[model samples]
Target chain A: MALIELRGVSKIYHLGGEEIRALDNVDLDINPGEFISIIGPSGSGKSTLMHILGCLDSPSKGSIKLDGMEIGSASARELARIRNQKIGFVFQFFNLLPKLNVLQNVELPMVYAGCSSRERRERAMDALRLVEMDNRAKHRPMQLSGGQQQRAAIARALVNSPKIVFADEPTGNLDSHTGETILKLFHDLSLKGSTIALVTHDPEIAAVTPRKIEIRDGKISKNVDAKLSGQHDGPKFAVGSQQN
Target chain B: MSLLNAILVGLREIWAHKFRSLLTMLGIILGVSSLIAMSAIVKGMEHGMKEAMIALGGLDKVLTREAPVPTWQSHLSDQARGRTMRDVEALQRSAPLIRMVSPEMALERVTISRGDKRTRPSEFVGVWPVVIEMNLHNLEHGRFFNDVDEANAHAVIVIGTAIRDDLFGSPEQLGREVIPIGERVQINGQTFTIVGMFEHYESDQDRKKREWAREHPDEAAQKQAVARGRPGYGGGGSRSGWAFDRKNRTVYCPMNTMWLRFRAASGTGNVPDPTLTDIDFKVEDLSQMEDALQQAKNVLLTTHNGIEDFSFSTQEGNIESVDQAIRNARMSGGIISAISLLVGGIGIMNIMLASITERVREIGIRKAIGATFLDVFTQILVEAVVIAIIGGLAGLVAANLLVRFLASLSPTGNTPIVTFEAMAMAFGFSVAIGVLAGLFPAFKAAKLNPIQALRYE
Candidate 1:
């Protein structure tokens, strides 16, 4: 079954008395274990789509189903519960709480999920090891490099064992090398059967995900697989294998 | 998130900005302290005045006098109004709670002289000896006047210690016969002789007694000295020792003697002269003082034909009133002192509010991590209450130290004390201030939107 499904979802914003359309009639389905990417220009609505799919924002129109639950009609409390239980978020800026060390950031989702402290610690360590960041668990985000911060953010998302992890411009603020490494981390997670939705303007990131969708002027313009685009440079590199 | 976790985070945020927290709580602290201070001052006043009144005389006695409706407003009349020799007799006859009661005659500006010894201006009041004895006479020499003196319109006198100094300069004046200025003693045309001397006394023994006497010169403290039997002096000027040449001073004399000699009026064509102004009677039993006073009230009420003009002022209540007056005087002062505490409470409140503003994201994070709004609200509220309680306790300790310092300044060696109520009230006010001030900010924290909060910088 699809973990996330949207049908004719649209969002409009009122800014200074002028209507701004952020999304329009977007329909998509993301199955569990699939690695997907949505690519577009800055104002093309991909980020807004990520926000809705992650349950951070609700659809203004149309029905949204997360793992077959009608999330569009969910109350604020229900949305919070869904956010804590199902979706993990990664921002380009890493979004690691500055006051928390790496392990705490990773363990945060489990803490919110009502897991025992011991259980939270155990799951956090597993996620950290999965992202190859177990050794830097005690360090604050400021002490980690761009690539490590993104890895930590990814670890935090996975600690709750959510059905899908959403990354917004995951490498927008990182160097090319760091960006490529972070994309490989997405590839690695996908190999381990973790579903991911990567939102970015970079074709390189879109190339890393097996399935790609393009957004233009607040609407989905195309659905193109990486093989269909004939972009194979990303998989050839094993970019996340820097530890090897 | 658990309450423990929320509190931990709230405290961490507060600790992170210590100075801001202190500043915010300033207002709460001051408001609490001011309330406590006013309470304390009132307590002190009550205590001080009670002591003063108790020392004046026991609360048991009542003063009675003959006063017809004067041209002035009767409402402003002294408590002694409506009491006459007849009222004293009626009270002495019918009150079941009767302790002994005595009557006094007032003589004004009477004079006396003997040979070359002319007495200075003074008072001459005829008094019964047993009534004087009711007041535990701490005589410097001779005893208070006896009933025999009242019967004979005694040439004998009981003088204050001050009189000894003016007449003979020592206790040796006990037996000396000083000439009254009137050749005997005169007040509206009557005369008497001085036969005995006693000790001088300043009415108030409180620390401010001398100062009050100094300031109010014409009252009880600042008056001229005189001899009882001097040719021109009146019966030794009551308690104040005023000067007179049978003319300017009012004196104290036995009511019995005064009634017989000068106060009696005939209902003929001749108009009667008003001679006796008032009478202060002492009671024997201190415990029965009120009962005696009530009895006197009932008897006098009827004797005067329901004249409510007479008032019975209790010595205890008088002293209590003084205490009340003192406390009332210090009400504003106490508030001023506690103003600092209010500033401190506000300091704490300010700190908490600033902290709420700074940790918006943390609150968002906690909520996102499963913290209930209740958890967040309680966390902030507890922090504020804690600051207030601590500050309030500190103020209480300071107040005690201040009271002790004031106590050291008291003449009786009694300390100005702080009651438990004051202590509790101070702390209670502090906490109240904290809660009241913290309520709005804590509510804001509880209502924060997790998504928007997470997005906050």
Candidate 2:
């Protein structure tokens, strides 16, 4: 069974007495251990679909299930709990709280999860170690470079071990070399069986994932699976050892 | 989030903007300190007023004075015989509730003289030895009149220090203590020997001032010289000091001596008016004052042939006035302080609103990490309350300093007392203000949409 299933999901908004449909009858499924990318231009409703899938918002009309639990019609509080336990998001700006150090930033998810401080500390350190950011745990986000900040943000996203992780233009703020390194890190995480969906406007970044879902004009335009098509030529970047 | 974490976050937030937080807390600090300081001043005033009340005898003392007959008994007004020794004897013999009765025969406008010095005593009363206890007098030197003095009408007198100061010389001027025992003086052209002299009566503040002057004579002399050069300087003493001054200007002689030597010679038809000037008594228990007054009234009624011409006046009226003044002072002070505190709360609310606005992006980040509305709300509320708590503590310290400064500024004024109850109440008010101030801002922050907040920039 799919880890997340969305059928006929729609999000509507009203502005100046005019109805605007941001999402219209979207149907999609994401299985466990699948690396996928949702790609589209701005105003194509792909961001709205990511928001609904991430549980930051509820669908106006649809049946949406995550890990076999229906959540499309859940209350705000219930949706927050689902978001805390079952999902994680990585924003383009590396949204680590500036006042907190990297370790404290990573522990924030479990802080809301109501985990014991001891458990949160241990899990947060482990997540930092996985991203090779354990050494920078005590440093604030402002002190770190763009790549390091994004790496720390990734550690925060994985600290709770959610069922799905959504990266929204994670490398959009970094230079090309740093962006390549972050994409390689994502690929390595996928190889280790983590379900990550990269949402971006760049086709080059989306090509790193084996499966791609493209959306345009409030509807899905294409859903392609390179592994199933037996045409999985890996990302254009050279496959090399991890670099810090 | 757990409350502990929220508080930690709140504290960190305050620490991040220490200057702003301190400025925000300044209002609360001023408010709380003013509240405590205001109460302390009122408390000091109450203490001084109560002291003056006690100086005028005590709460248990009641005066029996002559009053006109009621309108219903107007036709019988001519039959009224004023308070006299007969009523005093009757109350002493029949009224068990009346502990002691002192009959006073006052010679109004009486002048005492020695050599060329002449001074008018505030009160020239002829009384029994019980007058000392009735008036709470402290006879520091010489002997009071004995039964022989009253029975034989001895020409002896007991005078307060004020009269002696005028007759001979004040100890302050003579640079030594003076005991005028056995000194010959004349009262209204009648020779009398001073038998006793009561101590100088003065308020605690006045006593302190005198002692301070005695210790620092040079400074006192300089200040006095400066005051002499400037009119109205040190001329107006404390309002309550008049009570002490009046007590010090009294002169007492034997009851028969005042009647036989003074009133007897000045009465109508050459017959001495047998009426006593004043009849004062003390009750056994203050709580049973009404019943005791009633008992004395019943006894006096029998002696006066049911004339109903005299009435009772308890010290309770004076005490009630003092209490009313204290209550009025406290109410006005409390209102002013509470207004400042509310203004302080508004200051906090204004800052909290601005703070949340500045942290919109932060709020969005926190909400995106699965923080519920309650968590955000508690975080903001805790921050405001923490500011208040800190401000309240600082205010207590400030109040202590303020009170001390005031005491030093007027060392002779009533010393302001800072009570623990005032501190606790001020602190409690500040915290309550903090909560009220934080509510709107917390609600606004917590109700923010995560997406819109992220886009707030």
Candidate 3:
């Protein structure tokens, strides 16, 4: 069975008496250890789909399941629990809390997960180490470079040991070189059997992922499985080494 | 998240916006501090007024006398009768609440002399020994004449400190045989032994009156020199139709001794001159003062054959007026302080709303990180309460300091008392304001949609 399944999901918003369909009849499934990208231009409902999948929002109409639990039918408390235990999100602007240092920011999800402070500290440090941000753990978000901030955000996402990580334009604020470095980190994570759903408007960014779901006009227009194209980067990194 | 984490977050938000937080706290601080200040002031005023009332013989001292009827009206109505020793005895027997009746007859402008030392005639007050306590006078030396002295009409006197100094040398000569106890002094050609000396009791109002009189000696003496049969006594302007002249310079003797020795010089020279100038009735309990006064009045009326010649007056009436004024002041101060607190709560709410708006994105980020509505609500509410509490504490400290400073400057020796109850009340009110003021803003923040919040700038 797929780790996540979405069928006939739709989201409609009303603006000044006009009905705008942000997402229309989207059907999708994500397997464990998959590296996938949802690609679309601005206003293509890609961000809305990411919000629904991350459980930050519920579909206006849909049957959505995560880790065998229904997403759309879950209570707000349950959604929060799923978000804390089952999924992690990295946003476009490197959404690190400005007041907290890198280490405290990384420990946020674990804090929600009710992890003991000692365990949270150890796990957050390990996550920071995975993203090469451990040395800057004491620094606030604004003190770091755009790439460094995103690295800390990724550490925060991985701190909870979520089964699926969603990156919504994760490198949108970074230069190409930093963006490429972040993509390589995602690739390393995916190769190590950590499922990643990377959302981006850039086609080149989408091309690097093994699978792509291209969205247009609030609907999925094309789906591609490119496992063979990305085969050379697989099995190069140790699996579960960071987790253990 | 734990409560500590939420508190830490709230603290950080306040620290991040220092100026805005202080401005928001201004209302609570002002409210709570003023509450403390007002309480202290009112308490101090109450203490001062009570002291003043007690100094003026207090609510338990009632004076009764014949109602003044003009000579022309005296014939039309029953002749105005005087309050006498018989009437005093009658009230004592009839009024259960009347503890003691001190009848006073005065011998004014009589010469007092001992050996070569002599002073101008001061009024001599003849009363029972209980008048010492009833009039709140303290004996400086020896003892007041007791029942034996009154019943036997012994020619013994307790001179005021001023008269002691005049008849002898200065106060240091007191024990050195100058105006010594058991030594004789002459009042209106009659010799009396000095039995005691009373310490001067004067209030601030009395002191001010004395100061004014000293400043205008000629006018004061002229106004007071009238040989009116009853001298104006209690030194303040006549309010209750009588004045108790300063007791500091007068002589006190047994009523029988005064009447026997100085009756010719004291009253209208009529045989069987049974007129008593004033009667001092000490009620057993202050709570029953009105009833005691009424009962005494009935006794006097029936004894006088329903002539209604005597009128009753209590120092308690004066205390009531003072109490009413103090109560009004306290109520107004409380209302003003309450307004300040209310304004402070509103200010806190306004600031909290603004804080929520400014941190919409932050709220979104927290929400996305598995923070439920409860978490968000608690964080905002905690921030508001924290601000209010901090302000409240600051106000408490400020009010105490201000009260102490004001007390130090008071000339009347009125020290504002900051009771524990006042501090606790102010602090509790501040916290309540914080919670109440923070509620709506916290609710607004909690109700925010995570998606919409993240989208907000």
Candidate 4:
């Protein structure tokens, strides 16, 4: 069974008496331990799809299920609970709270998860260790380099061990070398059986994932699985690493 | 999120902007302190008024004053006879509600003199010995006029400390206390022996001042030296001080002595009137004051031939007026403090609004991490309440200092008392204001769309 399933999901907006559809009848499924990327340019509604899949928003008309529980009709509070327990998001800007240290920032998701402080501390340390950021736990985001901050943000995303993690332009704010390192980290995390989705406008970044879903004009233009097609090579991280 | 975590986050937010938080709390501090200080001042005023009321013969004492004949009884006005010993004797016999009566015959414009020193007394009334209890006088020395003095019309007088101070010399000046017993003084060419002296009457604040002065004699001497040539410096210049001063300047003599020497010698045609100048009495039960007054009125009506030319005045009217004045003062002070507190709440609200606006991105980040609307709301609300609670505590300290400063400004004025009730109430009010102030800002932050908030630059 898929970890997340979306059928006929739509998001409509009304601006000054004009109806604008940000998402139109999107059908998709994400299985456990799958590494996928949703690629599109600006204004292509890929962000909207990611928002809906991440439980940050509910669809206007759809049947959406996450981990076998229907959530499309859930209230805001229920959605927040689902988001806290079943999903995590990494933003392009490394959205770790500036006021908190890296450790505290990583502990934030579990803090909302209502975990005991002891448990939150232990789990946050484990997540930071997973991202090789345990040594920088006490450093604030502002004091860290771009790659370190992104690592910390990824630690925060994995702190709660959610069913799925969404990275929206995860390397958009970093240099090419730092971006390559972050993408390799994501590839490593996916190989370790974490279900991860990268949302980006760059095809090079999307090539790191085995499966790619391209969105255009509020519709899915292509959904490709390299493992099933046997026509595309595996993740090009080796080629990128050779260049590095 | 748990409440503890939310409060921790709120506290961190405040700590991040310490100067701004302090400025935001300034309004609450001023409000709470002013509220407490204003109540303290009103409390002081009430204390002074109550002290003055007690000095005016207490709450149960009633006076029977002569009034003009009513219009309906104008034809029988000639038959009207004023309050006299007849009415006093009648009330004692017929009015069971009347506890004790003191019929006074005042000799107006009286001056006592010994050697070259002389001073006019506030009241020089002739009375029976029962006048001591009727007037709440404390005879500190010698003895009151006995029945033998009243029967034989003895030329004896009992004076207050003020008259003693004037006739001989005050203890402060003579460096020794004078009893003045067995001393002779002349009143209008009539020689009278001083038989007793009442204690000096003063409010609590004045008593403390006097005792403090006595304890530090050198300081008292220096103060007197400085005030020697200043007009009204040593006098009872305050509004409520006169009550105590007037009580201390009284002179009393035997009622028959007054009738024989002063009243009997001066009348419309050289015939004694025999009418009493004042008739004052106390009731057995303060709760039954109305009934007691009615009974006394009935007894006096027959004594005055049903002329209705007299009226009874109870201290209750004076007490009501004093209470009304205190209520007015408290209301005005409360309103002013409440306004200041409201302004403080508005200040909190304004700052909270600005604070949430500054943290829009922060809110978005938290919300994206699975923080519910309730969590964000509680965090903001807790921050505001924390500011108020801290400000409330600081205000209490400020109020204490403010009250002390006020007391020092007028040392003789009633000392402002800070009650625990006032502090608690002010604190509760500030907290309530904080909650009210936090509501709009918290709602605005909680209702923000996470996507748009994340997009907010």
Candidate 5:
């Protein structure tokens, strides 16, 4: 059975007296250790789909089952528990708490999970080390470069040991070199059997991932083949190589 | 997360916005300090008033004096006279609630001496042994005259604070047991032994005298020398109308002792040896003062053949008027200060609301990371309370210092009594205000939609 299953999920939004279908009868399934990219234009409702899939927002209709538990109708607390223990999210804005140093930001999830201080500190350090951010552990988000900030944010997402990771334009604010480094980090985690979902508006960004799901006008345009051929083009690239 | 972590976060947030936090706490600080200061001032006022009452004997005492003759009368009649010893005897017989009636007599400008240490001529009081108890003069050392001393016409006296300093050379001697009982002194060329000393009851006049003495020690010494050279120059200044003030410089001897040694031996023509001034009446119980006063007045009028010559003054009535004034003062002060506390609580509420608005995204992020609504609510509530408590504790410290400084400046040198209950009350008020003020803001923060909040700019 798939690790995550979405059945006929539909979402409608009312904005200024106009009915807009943000997600129309979307059905999808994600297997364990799958590295998938969701691609769409600006108004394609890809972010809304990611929000629903991550359980940050509930689906307006249809059932979502993760690990055999239906989540579409779950209570707020249950959704919060699923977010904390099962899924990790990295946003376009990084979303690191600015007042916190890198290490404390990474420790935030375990803090809500009620982990002991010693264990939290150890796990946070290990996560930062994995993202090559342990040296900047004491630096606040504002003190870091854009790439370093995203690295710290990724460290935070991975620190909880979630079953799946979601990146919504994780490289949107970074230089191409830094963006490739972050993508390579995601690839390494996926290769290590961690389920990954990468959301982007650029087809080239989606081309690097093993699988791609394309969205258009609030509906799924394509559920591509299991593997996109010739996408593992090494973790590093020459500077300024990729563009819109 | 545990409550401790939440508290630490709150504290850190406060510290991050130091000026804003201080401004938020200002209202609470002012409210708490004013409350404490007002209580202290009221307490000091009560202490001063109570001491004054004690000096006037007590609420159960009454003073009866001869009333002036009717102003409508055109002709002067020699038959109408002031109260006499006979009237005192009549009251003693007529009023069962009257415990004792003591007579007050004064010998103006009499020299008092002990070896070389003599007070310049001051008033000399002649009173019965019961006069000491009736007047409520606190004895600092030795003892009051007893029936044995009065009966024997013993040359024994209890000096007042002023005279104690004058004759003994130091007021500190009174408290140190330096002036032993049976120590000899002389009053009006007659020898007397010091039997007791009166504790100094402070008044505005007393404070002035002390301040004067402190500023002009040499001048005071020269004046004492000049008064010593002349016999009648330094008596309890006849201008000091208080009987206690006069007594301070005057010598107190048993009424019989004054009659036997000075009145009988001297050639000065005056009323009979046992002639009286105003008589002091002590009721058996405080509640019986009104009845006691009326009965004594009736007896005095009857004894004088219905002349209605004497007027009565009850300590109970005097104290009630004074107490009413104190209560009025306290109520006004309390109301004004309580308003300050209310303003402080409102300030807390305002600041908490602003904080919720400023941290909307933070709240969303925490919720996104699995913080329950209850968790977010408690966190904000903790932040508000911490601010209140900090402000309250600061107010307490400031109030205490202010109270001490004000007491030091006061003539009576009385400070506010900082009761444990008052501290706890002030602290508890701040905490309650924290919770109340934080409630709406915390609720608003907790109810924010995670998706909307994360998207908030």
Candidate 6:
């Protein structure tokens, strides 16, 4: 079974008495150890798809399967358990609990998941080491540089050893140099047997991921391989090369 | 939640805005203080009144006096002077249901002289042994007259403590002899010997009884020197107005002896007409006293051909009425205090509700983090109760201090005694107020929905 699967997934929100379809029967599959990026414009439903795949929100009329286990139809507690145990989220804004230091912020998932203090501390330290943020563990987010804060957020997401990492515009708030550095870390995580799903609009940010899926007008419109360094052939694209 | 965690949470929240929390606690503090102060004041008054009642010789007693208010009046003709020995007999028969009832005859205007060391108008109370015990009197010396004196019509007397000091100036005059101011030299011509003396209230009544023997030292000296023989030259005479204020004073002689000497030689055989008043009677229980007095009155009224001039009285109802009034005042004061506390409790409830609204977000977070609603509710309620309990203790101290300060400045200059009942009730009521004050806040906290609460901005 695929590690991440979306079956006829769609999201329709009733906002102010108007039906807004954020996803239109989106179907997708990606295997373990795949580094994937879903890229699109602001209203192209790419962020909505990321939210659904990350378990932060559920699709209105579809099933989400993670590791051959159905999660979309599970109870609220079960959903929260899946979020804590199977999914790790990295946001462009770096939503760190401001009161906690680098080490404490990284320990949040384990704390919520009821890990023992000693294990949580050791695992958080290991995650920070993997992100090259172990030296800055005692500094709060406000005290750290932009790249260091993002790295700390990565440690928090990875501290629970989740099955998948879902990052939405992870480098959107960083300079190109820091953004390149973060993309390299994601590549390294994927190489080390972790599945990575990232969402970004920057072609440079997307180019590092091995697989790319595009969303437009609440539907999948573009599919390509960023690792292949190939072009997109579409209604709105100029093809450098085409892939069958 | 752990108790420590809950208490810490309460303390931390309260400390976050000290001014607001302290203001909220004021309502409970005021309520407790008022209850304590009110109870203390009423308790003090009750104590003072009881002491005064006892001083009037009727704290828990009932003495039968000629009532109808006119019984003790002088203008009722000399015919209504006192009672016959038959009245005493009837009183002794009908009176029960109490501890002691000793007949008393008190006289004033009696003079005493010991080798020109004179005491004029000395007050004397003639009492049977039981009557002395009825007053809870602790004697300094001597004993009371026994039944033998009554059977023999002996001329023996018991005197007040004040009179004893005035006549002898010392208690060592216990075995000495003295005389009463009267021409009953041998009391209807029966020679009497001075036996014992006793002390009652602030002086030696026992010594004064010895002084009654001293009034006729010549009769006593001759009797002691000679053996028992009927060869003594002493005479008995009729009653003399100069010897006593018969209307106001009572001289306790045995009823048999009183009738033998003072009863008129009237035509009634079984009992010398009871109308010929000389012997007086007293009853034991205050409740039974009125009936005993009424029986005597009925007997007299029937014998006196329905002359309504005579009266009977018992201090029973008057003293008890005052006691009941004090009790009623205490109850009303307590109720008023309770109402004020309730008003204050409502104020506390309102303030707690406001606090709950203010901390809505914190409550939501705590609940979302696996804290049961009971945990949140109990934490808030415990906070309110703690504030009240602290205030109650402070109020107790304050009330006691106020009682002491006010007692010192009282116009009557009597010591104020605050009873234990009033203090205990005040403390208990303050605690109850704490529990009552928390009810609304607890319910509000418990009823909060986690979803809605988390959504509260």
RMSD of 3: 7.3
| Consecutive 10-residue window with the lowest summed lDDT within model 4 chain B | B231-240
Better of 4 and 5 by TM-score: 4
Compared with the true structure, the alpha-carbon lDDT of candidate 5 equals: 0.81
Candidate 4 C-alpha lDDT tens digits along A71-137: 9999999988888888889999998899999999999999888999999999999999999999999
Tens digit per residue, CA lDDT, model 5, A108-140: 999889999999999999999999999999999
Could you give candidate 5's per-residue lDDT for residues B1-457 as a string of tens digits? 7888889889998999999999989898988888888887877777777776766567677888767766653143345666766877887888898988888766767787777776663457788777768876678888888889889988888877677676665643343545546777777676788888777655566467666866888887777677676655233333333655555554678877877787666544754544466688788887776777777867876776666656887766667887898889778987887788888888988898988898888888888777878888999999999999999999899889878888778745555676666677877887888888889988999889988998898
Give per-residue CA lDDT, model 4, range B9-100, as digits (tens).
88888899999989889999999999999999999988987776766677788989989999999999988878889999998899888899
B1-457 per-residue lDDT for model 2 (tens digits): 9989988898899999999999999999999999999999999988977776767778788988888888888888888888888888888899998899999989887889898899999899999999999999999999999999989999999999888888889999999999999999988899999999998887676787789999999998887777676554123345567777788889999999988888888778887788888899999988889899899888888887777898888878788888899999999999999999999999999999999999999998888879888889998999999999999999999999999999999887788989999999999999999999999999999999888887788
- Model 6 misplaced regions, further than 4 Å: A135-138, A225-244, B1-457
Off by over 4 Å in 4: A15-19, A236-244, B64-124, B133-143, B146-153, B159-192, B196-251, B255-312
Full-model lDDT, candidate 2: 0.90
* 4 or 6, greater by lDDT: 4
Candidate 3 vs candidate 4: the lDDT winner is: 4
Kindly report the fnat of each predicted structure, to 2 decimals.
Answer: 0.26, 0.55, 0.57, 0.77, 0.64, 0.00
Those runs of model 5 whose alpha carbons end farther than 4 Å from true positions after fitting are: A228-244, B59-130, B138-149, B152-203, B206-328, B411-413
What are the per-residue Cα lDDT tens digits for candidate 2 across A102-160? 99999998999999999999999999999999999999999999999999999998988
Order candidates by TM-score, high to low. Answer: 2, 4, 3, 5, 1, 6
Best by TM-score: 2
Report the number of the highest-lDDT candidate: 4
Kindly report the docking quality category of candidate 6. incorrect
Residue ranges of candidate 3 with Cα displaced over 4 Å:
A228-244, B59-126, B139-143, B146-148, B156-202, B206-251, B255-320
Evaluate residue A33 in candidate 5 and report its C-alpha lDDT on the 0 to 100 scale: 91
Clashes of 2: 0
- Interface RMSD, per-candidate values to 1 decimal: 2.9, 0.8, 1.1, 0.7, 1.0, 6.4
lDDT of model 1 at residue B100?
A: 64
lDDT per model, in order?
0.67, 0.90, 0.84, 0.91, 0.81, 0.65
Report clash pairs, candidate 4: none
| Candidate 6 residue lDDT tens string, B1-457 | 4566456556766676677666666665666666666666666677766665564455445444453424444455555434434445544554443344455543335444444454443334444566554655444344456788778767665444444445555433465544333222132233433344343332123234346557877776675566345442112112222222221122244544544554434335745443432233445444566565666667656544455555554555666787798779878977887887777677668877887897676565344333455666788888777666766776677677867887778645445566677677777887788778887798788667644564476
TM-score of each: 0.68, 0.85, 0.77, 0.80, 0.71, 0.52
